[model samples]
Each structure stands twice: as structure tokens, then as C-alpha cells.
Target: MMDTMFLKAALAVYFVSVLGYVTSIYVRRVMVAKVSTWIFFLAFLCHTISFIFRYLETGHTPVISIYETLSFFAWAMAGVYLAFQPKTKTRVLGAFVSPVTFLLMIAASKGLEGYVSIPEVLKSNLVPLHVILSVTGEALFALASFAGAMYLIQEGLIKNKKVSGFSRMLPSLSDLDRINHFCLMWGFPLLTLGVLVGSLWARTAWGSHWQWDPKQVWTLVAWVFYALLLHQRLAIGWKGHKAAFLSLLAFAILLVSLVAINLFFVTAHSFI
Candidate 1:
């Protein structure tokens, strides 16, 4: 009962945060931005508490269900945004990001009926660590993809003289491109560490470092896509739309691996 109430409250706050972000885009009032920022911060706090309570209620990490996994990603997304806030003027990007986070929260809200439990194999400590690091790392890369996609969209509009509405709300294309590259450069190492940790965990549990499981195969594919992007950007002087396109390509791979493949396919690594 308490869990239900807390979850409800958390979802409410997430919705409020979404509205706040939308309002920030239109109002142009400094006071409005301040209010919305506070609202989002408050929403994040409520979400943190809700996740904590859920954790206390269940001994397992909250990565067992697709809903919970999405919720965790939303949290990590907000965390990454908050971290980058002071360093860069990416607050406008939040107008795009907050809605995504809200949708994830709403998705999480959809399926909470049963007492969720971890599978027997997933109860291991390594599995939990692997999930946490890998998911969080992926979350950062997801944000980078969002930034990169917007960068390309905005870049096209500027190239074609169509800057208005949400396009105007975005930062300069240069800034977006720079941040996109920055995010990949920063996120890649974490992602590599996550893959490494997960590989070690897999070897321990399944007696093979590489299983070619659907999850493993797709994850490696995503990694290689980003790896190629990094190489193109650094070694071959790729920039602007090219890099942004690569980022979008990597994001597509991630979506297929994270969402589509996991949903439709059977695999030994399907913890969710």
C-alpha cells in the first residue's frame, strides 16, 4: 500500500517536472525558469525517495523488471543532466530530455501489480553490479544521442533557414556538436568499463567471456558502432552532421539491443 502511494506520488512529480520543462520553453520569464527548475529538482528528490523505499522493500536492485529498469534509466538521465548543468548551457536541452524522462516514468508506472522477484541466476552480486554500471553508462550515452540528434536537426534548420519554435530553443549547433562529442568521449570509457565488468561477470557465471547471446551480441554491436564513431571523429576528422549521424546510428543500435531484441528474443542474459 505504501509502495503504491509513493509510486503514485513520484509519478505525479515526474509529470509536474515535464510540465515545468515545457513551461520553461514558452514563458521566457526568469521567474518561471526558476520555479520550473525547483519543481524538477523536487521531482528528482521524490523519485530518489521512491526508489529508495522500493529498494528497502525488496532486497534486490530495482533492475529486474522492464519498468524498474526504465525508471532507473530515467534517474540516471536526470543525474547526468544535473552533472552537466553547471559546466555547460544545456538547460534548453532539458526541454527535450524531461519529456523523455517523464515518459519512462509513466512506462514504469504501468506495471506494478505483482511482487517482483529476481531470477535465481540474477540474484548474484556480480549481476547487480553489472546491471547498475551497464545501465547507467548506457543512460549517459542515451543522453548524448539525444544531444546529437537535436544537434543534427538544428544544424539542418540553420543550413536551410528554418530556425523557429523548438529549433530556436536549442543551443547553437556548434555547442550541441561539441557537447555531443564531449559526451561520447566521456561516456565511452564508462561504457567500456561496464562492458568489461559485464564480461567478467558473464565468465564467472556462464563459464564463457563471450556467449553470443542476443543481449551480448547486440551490446557488442552497440559498442563497436560507438567505437567506430570515435575513430571517425578522431582519426578521420569527422565533424558536425557526420558525427551527429554516427551518434544517431549508435543510438539506433542501442534501442534495438536494449528494447526490441530484449522484448522479442529469448536469451540466457535476459535478466529483465
Candidate 2:
């Protein structure tokens, strides 16, 4: 009950914060953006309280079920956005982030609304660590691709000399590009670590590190795609459009691995 109450409260405040952000974008006001930012922070704090209560109720990490996992995933997305928003001069990004966060939370709250006890076989410590790390990495990639997409739109508007209020509200190309780059730079290593931990867990549970399950195989594919993004960004000095488009593509593949595999394929991950 506390979980549901707090979660609903957080969602309500978060929606207000999103409205503030959208209004700021349309009105082109820094003060409104700043207010929206603080509102977002408040919403995050409320969400954290819900998570805390959920954990106390469950006696374990509040990430076992799909909805719970998605909730945490949304939290990570907001956390990362909060961490850099002040410095990025990209308050306009709230236009994207707020909706995404709100949608994920909505999805999380739409399920059976009952606690799912963890299976005995999934009680391994590695399970929690793997989920947290993988979720965090995916959150980062999600932001990166969003930034990349924003970059393309802004770039197009600029090239066509569609200089107007909307164009002005968009973050500069350099800022968006930097966000895309920064997220990718960090996301890949985190994802790699998650994959490694997952493999370790697999070996412990099934006596085999490589199962070639749909989740495993597609995870490998996403990993390779991100690795290519990193290589192109670092080793090949790719930046701007090339990096942005590739990050977007990598994120799309990540969605397939995460959502498609879970829904369509019978894998060890789905079992968990």
C-alpha cells in the first residue's frame, strides 16, 4: 500500500514537472526551466522513497519483476539526467526525458500490482548486481540515442536556416553531441561489466557460461554494436552526425535485445 501510494504521488508530481519543462521550452524561459529542474529533483526524491518502501517490504532489491525492473530503469534514466543537466545547458532535453520517464513509470504501474517473490534459483548475489548494472547501462544508452536524435533534428533545422523559436530552444549541436558521446563513453564499459557478471551467474546456475539463449545472443549483438560505436568514436575520431546516428542505431538494437527477447523468446533471462 505504501509502495502504491508513494509511487502514485511521485508520478503525479513528476507529471507536473514534465508540464513545467514543456512549458519552458515553448515559452523559452530560463527561469521556468530552472523551476522544472528543481521539480524533477523533487519528483526523483519522492520516487526514491517509493523504492525504499518497496525494498523494505520485499526484503531484497526492488528489481525482481519486470515492472519493478522498469521502474528502476526509469529511475536510473532520471538520475543520470539530474547529474548532468545543470552543466549541459540542455534543459531543453527535459522535453525528451520527462516524457520517457513518465511513460516508463506508467508502464511499471500498470501490471498486477502484486509483489513477486524471487525464485530460489535466482537468489544469487550476482543476479541483483547484473540487473542493476545492465539497467544503468541501458539507461545511459537510451539517453545517448535520444541526444543523438535531437542532434539530427537540430542539425537539420540549422542547415535549412529554419532559425526560429523552436530551433533556438534546442540545445546546440556541440552540447547534444557531447551528451551522446559522454553517455556512450561510459555506457559501453558498464554494459560489458554487466554481461560479464551475467555470464558468471550463468556458469554458477547452469554449469555453462555460454547458453546461446536468445537473450544471451542478442545481448552479445548489442554489445558488439556498442563496441563499434566506442571504437568509431575513440579510435576513428568519429563525431557529430556519424557518432549520433550510430549511437541511435545501437540503442535500437538494445531495445530489441531487451524487449523483443523478453516478449518473444524463451530464454534464461525471461525465466528470471
Q: Tell me the whole-model lDDT of each prediction, alpha carbons only.
A: 0.78, 0.87
Clashing pairs in 1: none
Candidate 1 wrongly placed segments (more than 4 Å): 1-4, 164-166
Question: Tens-digit lDDT track for model 1 on 62-139?
Answer: 667788888888888877877786677767777777788888888887875455666676777776676677778788
lDDT for model 2: 0.87
Best by lDDT: 2
Cα RMSD for candidates in order: 2.0, 1.3
lDDT of 2 by residue, 29-115 (tens): 899999998998898988899899988887888877888888898899999999988788788888799888999999888851767
